[model samples]
Target: MDQKIKSVFDLQQKYKFELRKTDSKTRIAKLKKLKQALESAEEEIYVALDKDLRKSKFETAVTELFFTYAEIDHAIKKLSGWMKPKSVGKTMSNLFAGNKIYYEPKGVCLIIAPWNYPLQLIMSPLISAIAAGNCAILKPSELSNSTASVIHKIISNTFEEREIACFEGDAETSTSLLKLPFDHIFFTGSTAIGKIVMEAAAKNLTSVTLELGGKSPAIIDDSCDLKKAAEKIAWGKLVNAGQTCIAPDYVLIDEKLEKEFVSHFTVAADKMFFNYGKINDEVFGKIISEKQFNRLDGLIKKAVIEGAILEFGGETNPESLTINPVVLTSVSAENSIMQEEIFGPVLPIIKYKNLQNAIDFVNSKDKPLALYIFSDSAKNQEKIINETSSGGTCVNDVLVHISNPNLPFGGVNSSGIGSSHGIFGFKNFSHERAVVFQSKFGMTKMIYPPYNLGLLKWLKKLM
Candidate 1:
């Protein structure tokens, strides 16, 4: 641990108590400053995201910048209500006592973000931390260096070091930060890295909220409108060139509709990405880096060698770090591509004989972060939802569930351990301290020590 980094941690530690005592007005004011800072840095954010991921201005604004703004606004609107102590229902044990769960700040917090959606992943948790009155330190991904630099500048200009700070570095920086004992840690990245974060936090028994990724599946029921389903999936999967955590990793559809679905998907993807028969460089984003491009390229090639058929879009331009949306068909369960979460613009469509088979196939893998179903049939939707487990689900749609701040965004088990967004995020950076005010004469006094066997029996019966 560098002395300067340790000093930063020390400053936050010393200031956590003061921060925790702040009123909702104070926290909301801080959030407002952050929102204003983001507004002032809008153009810089666009340029940074474009340089880092080749993201279009519209995409950057919609996915990253706007998301951070919305989260801050949501926190401002709901801060007072969220901060109030929640009263628990009356019970025998708590009779004559006021039991409330107080939302206390978790002191100092550490936020480790991923390269994809770098701004939102880092800022969303920071908004929650500030809303809950906790001091924080942010670690942005090194892969997205341009975006990271912009974030560091914004944070530096908008906040004091003790209240909020952003550190820009690689894995070594992350390892050093994990050595400290922060009250809570919020991480967003792959499951493998999430495990490392969890293991590090375990050393100090620090609480954690992991927003990790997994192989989220999309199911196309026979009853669904093939064109609509294809369009929705195409937009969701290709929005960030499929670098999204909850993007549909693979699709399961009936063999009968496979051909038609592929055709519709190709048209939808082309219309969205290609500008009237030509590659729309502005609308389409390039891969983040050559390293990532190579990984995706190799996956496509390996899948093909293993008998998977490339139905559409397999061309890659290494110089530009962009791979056209590749669609694979006849992909088996054992294909290497199927073994890992494909965090790229590649979509694999697997044909199933029946809905039950699709459900079974989804269940065979680790529970996904999201399970998307494309169907108008209430019966099918309900059945698929009930039979499958995921952190969240979208019916007849994709990716829009995250837009609702009222809903939590996260995963389950191997996918992730905790939740974020809205009140869920506030609670993630807070400790639900149990506070009880006992009345002068409480029923619990009857059970306090002494051999009152007869009285104990009577109290037990009463309880």
Candidate 2:
């Protein structure tokens, strides 16, 4: 481990006990200062995002900045309530004891954020960690170096190193950070890396909250309004050039509606990301890097070779590192594109004869981070939701579910572990310590070691 990094970790370890004692007012004030810093660095953020991911100013504001602001605001607004001890129901066995759950900081924490939505991912969990009164060390993805630099600036300028610190580097930096016994580790990134993080955390018995990604699906049946659904799906998939964790990796549509869906999807993409039939770089973002670009490019090529038709958008601009929104039709479940999370502007349309088949198909693979069901029938929605398990779900829409801070956002199994956002996020960084206030007289006395035969009989009968 680097001496500097080790020193920072030691500083935070020594400071964690004090940080855990901070009140909601102190935390809120810190959040407010963070918000102010974010405002001050808004232009720098935009420029950094543009340089790193080619994100437009408006898109940056909405997807990245807006989410961060909302999270901070939500935490500030709900911190007191969330900090209050939650009373738990009492049972006859403990009739004289008042049970409650007290939220406490999980000491020092390490937050590892991914490249995609680099700003928001780091800030969101940091907001939760601060709200929960934990000393945090942020490790932003090195792939998104520009945005990471901006984040380091914001964090360094706003907080003390002992209370909150940001380290900027490649996997080496992350590996060194992970070696420390952080009380909790919050990570948002690919499943492969998520596993690595989990492994490291296990060495210290460190608790972890992994926001990993999988091949989240969009199931569109005939019942949905094709045009409306197409438009929403287009925006969701192509907004960040399909680099979103919850972006529909592939569309499972009613077989008969494939043609109509393709037409609508193309129109939707063009309208959303084109001007005068030319690509609109402003509304759309470029692929993160040359490596990611080549990977996506390979997926599209392999899928076509294996018989999936390129329905729309396979054009790539190497110089700009941009791949236009791709739509693949007649895609097989076994296609190479379907094998992994296509974190790019590539959408494969797979036809399904029956809704049950679609559900079964999804079940055959890893549970997704998100499942999108675009159907009007409540029965259909209920059926899919009931039969399938995902980290989260959206009905009749797409990624908007993540915008609501009131909802918990995460994945299941390979997709992710644990949840974040709003109160759920605050709890993720907190330890729910169970507390009980016992009275002088208590029912538990009867169950003490004396084990009187008559009292045992009475307790057994009561149970």
Candidate 3:
């Protein structure tokens, strides 16, 4: 084999053994140290993410720091119970023996995170890996290099090289790492890139949990309160300049109430990020790069050419990668605006003649990572909850479904594969081995058939 491949294999073998060598208590203490380092580096992390994507201190704390700290804190509290082996009842055949299922940590897991919520994406899975007693290798996005560097410094200082390590490099380094064998791979990013991660892991038949993004839909029913829906949707759209994977990508509003909803949305936008709101700045977030900005720019161009009216931000600042909060109206399903995930702060209002049409629009897309339905009506809420399938759902709130640790965060279909978070997150890195114990019943000697056809017939009848 080539030298590079040899080196990767060596690292993988070494890490796998290291993973099995550490006890759960040691791993938990390592996580505590990492968490303390993160807390100590809070200011540095905030500034770094801001420099990378202009993320605001509030947004950083809410989306990145808060989430990372929450996961760490939750794991610290529950690791003992979560790490205990699960006992199972003995079956009829296993009546004489004890049977139990153990949650053994899979050796050496790899986590690849995206740029949007750089710190959280990387650290959250790292939390799961540590909680499950597995060694982890964190490969953060190079697009958010400043924050990646800060993460590197904190983790290196806090964690032992074997228990946890941050690998800093570009796409080549990440791709190279993927080629190495991993016991489990947890990736959070775009579906396109997720496919590559899946394919690489397949070579070794490594299991994976993909937390990917798609055009997650938001439906505003006529029964919805325009004020409440507008406020929640506006906050979802404007946060981090709408770069979140779970952020509402497009909207489905009742046609008769569309104008009222848009007006309320305008009011809410003015309230959330007006001239005095401090949301739009180098301190707040920006689009990740010129390439992504240009992509959103292209969609805006297409919308304008198709006669779509801009209700809010119509253009982008390419120099600094800042895109103003743009709301579009007079949008059609055929327009480019409705084509795919507009990952920036651009929300398109899709008018629907009926609530079912809104449901159809969401159902038409692949199962999303997250879906939001804003309605006070029990009937409408029940329809959405029963009719659609997504990784998670939020009622009357946008993107709050992910906030609950009771729910697993992931997607289905093209949006993503597998799930994580909470107990599910820790178990995703665990190998659940099945065991069966057999007991010799009263008739164990009856199986021996030594040229006795009549006796065998009697035994079968008795059984």
Candidate 2 — which pairs collide? none
The runs of at least 3 residues in candidate 1 whose Cα sits more than 4 Å from the true structure, single-residue gaps closed, are none
Q: Each prediction's Cα RMSD?
A: 1.0, 1.1, 2.9
Per-residue lDDT over 37-148 for candidate 2, one digit per residue giving the tens place of the 0 to 100 score: 9999999999999999999999999999988998899899999999999999988877888899999999999999999999999999999999999999999999999999
Clashes of each: 0, 0, 3
Model 3 agreement with the true structure over 358-403: per-residue lDDT tens digits: 8888887778877899889999999988998887889889888777
List the global CA lDDT of all models. Answer: 0.92, 0.92, 0.81
| Model 3 bad stretches (over 4 Å) | 1-12, 21-23, 276-279, 282-284, 437-463
Q: Candidate 3, after superposition: displacement of residue 163 in Å?
A: 2.7
**TM-score, predicted candidate 1 vs. hidden true structure:** 0.98
